[model samples]
Every structure is written in structure tokens, then in C-alpha cells.
Target: MSTVQDYASRLSDPGSRKMGTFSYLPPMSPQQIRKQIDWIVQNGWNPAIEHVEPQHAMHSYWYMWKLPMFGETDIDLVLAELEACHRANPGNHVRLIGYDNFSQSQGANMVIYRGRAV
Candidate 1:
């Protein structure tokens, strides 16, 4: 298994040719995209309690994928935490409709919340 330092070194090393940057690549191939999606799904999904607005919820999907270290179980725990925190928040009235990996209304590849439309 790769250590944290190893992963950090890989990310920070300028000389090493890595496929980490999204800037150089255009839209990924179907297989590559599928692998990315699978990885993200395996890590898990979690909503941000402080930013649970319609836009935030929709944007959460992209944000979740951007986080490099999280795993599927971590995501499940995070979503649970968000839900509990959101429910306990004294002033906010936002509700979590839960996460859907494949949102048909949005698109097959897009992950989204199945709640109020933003």
C-alpha cells in the first residue's frame, strides 16, 4: 500500500509524468470516465451541511469527485454526519433527499440529489 507521504510526493513531484491533472486532458474516454465514476462511487457521497442550498447540493457531486483521498465508506459516514448536523442546525431548514449515483433526469453519468430542483 502507498503511504501518505508517497501519495503526496507523487502529487507534488513535477518531474514525474502522472495522469493527475485534468487540464491537459480533454473529456475522458468512456472507459476512463467510468473508472473515475466507479472510484468516486466506491468512496461515497456526502452533502455539505453549511452549504445545502439547491446550487450547493447540485455542485456537491462534482466537489465530491474532486476530493482525492475519500473512499466509499468515508462518504457514507460523511453523508450521515451531514444529515445529522443539518437536522440539528437551529436556523437552517434545508433537507437532504439523499444521494443518487446515476441521475436520469440530469444524465446517465451525472450524480445528483433526488430532491428539490435547483
Candidate 2:
């Protein structure tokens, strides 16, 4: 059996991790995320926001901020909601998720927006 120290030695350093669309890259700025959201909206995908504790990096689930924004195209509203979620869950890892079923058939796209540690 692997000891806690053994696991700790095998684990990579704690830091922001990449997921979906822009994996293997640095975290995107708010403006960059806004552009991606806009593009997804233009492509007819619904947007949703979710977050997770940084320490729970390997966990498969995240807490949803609000229901998916179906048919909503205004970027400001999304940005506002994202900001609110960040404020409410400071030090957590927030994400913007998009879903499209008709055009691309892909159900999800995700991007991380790391929150400042309080």
C-alpha cells in the first residue's frame, strides 16, 4: 500500500491546472474568456458556470453557480455572474462551461478561471 508520503512524493506541485478547450496552456484572462463565451454563444451553445475547491483538484464534480444560460447572448450578464460567483467563493477554482447539442453535437467545453486565494 502507498503511504501518504509516497503519494505526496508522486503528486505534482499544486497549481492551476488546464481543462477543456485550452488545456496545456496558461489560464485565460477575463477578456479572453469573454471572447470564447461570445463565440460559443454565437455558435448556439448555452453557457454555465461551476467551481471547485483547489485542493479538490482531482474531484469529478463541481458546484454550479446558476442554471445554464440557454439562448442568452449577452456577454456582460455572463461576466457579471462569473464575478459574483468569484466573490462568493473566493480562493476556489471557477470555470465557464458551454454546451452545444445541435450544431457540433459536443455537449461541453470548459475553461478555468482561477480565483484569488483569500
Candidate 3:
């Protein structure tokens, strides 16, 4: 059977716009973050950190922090990098990127911190 359907546009959320999977959820605990980072490492994905001003976060490519931790297996080191990014850019949105080498593409990306004060 073939069917034609018409769709209507709906109003956007009144809540402030958000980006990334974790951004829409409650702030992730350190344990949760550790678990996610662990998965990134276990999957051999290169971890990278990025940040951008909240105003630009919705429409801009986040600025990379230093460089991607290529060939890094230590989860603690990744966490440390994230912490440093936060310390240095406390007023910007921070995210974690897991890049897959074999696929030569991003395997995972998540918002680790939303720096805008609520």
C-alpha cells in the first residue's frame, strides 16, 4: 500500500536549547563519566575534548582542546584532560569526542559539561 501524509511544524521547546546526548539528561556523575570514558577506551576510540561558548555551542564547531589523545588507553589520563579543559574554560560548554581510527570517523560524542549558570 502507498500512502501520502502531510506533516505540520511544531513549536520548539521553551527550555534553553541543548546539544548532544548527555546534555538533555541530568548532569552526569563522575562515576557515570568514568564508565563512558572506559567504554571509549575499551573500544579503542581516540578521546578528544572540546569547548565552545554557550552562545555559539548550537551553531559552531567546538574548539579542540590541545589534540586528540591518540593511542591513549588510560581512562584516568582522559579524565584529567577533561578536568583541565574545565578548569581553563569554566564558562564554556565542554564535550568529549571518541574518534574511531578504523572507521576514520567519530564513534561517539557527548556533552560532559554545560558551563552556563542556570
Per-model CA lDDT versus the true structure: 0.35, 0.72, 0.83
Instruction: Point out where model 3 deviates above 4 Å.
Output: 1-15
Q: State which candidate has the highest lDDT.
A: 3
Cα TM-score per model:
0.23, 0.74, 0.82
Instruction: Write model 3 residue lDDT over 43-99, tens digit each, in one string.
Output: 999999999877677665789999999989898999999989999999887899999
Give the Å error, residue 42, model 3. 0.5
Alpha-carbon runs more than 4 Å astray in model 1? 1-20, 46-118
Colliding residue pairs in candidate 2: none
For model 1, residues 1-118, the per-residue Cα lDDT tens digits are 8764333323233323222244234545545544544554553542222323333332334222223222344445544554454455423323222234355121122222222322
Give the TM-score comparing model 2 with the true structure, all chains together.
Answer: 0.74
- Full candidate order by TM-score, most accurate first: 3, 2, 1
Clashing pairs in 3: none
Between candidates 1 and 3, name the one with more favorable TM-score. Answer: 3
Candidate 2 residue-wise lDDT, 39-102, digit = tens: 9788788888889876664578888898988788999998898888889988887877777757
lDDT of 2: 0.72
Residue pairs of candidate 1 with colliding backbone atoms = 42-72, 43-71, 43-72, 44-72
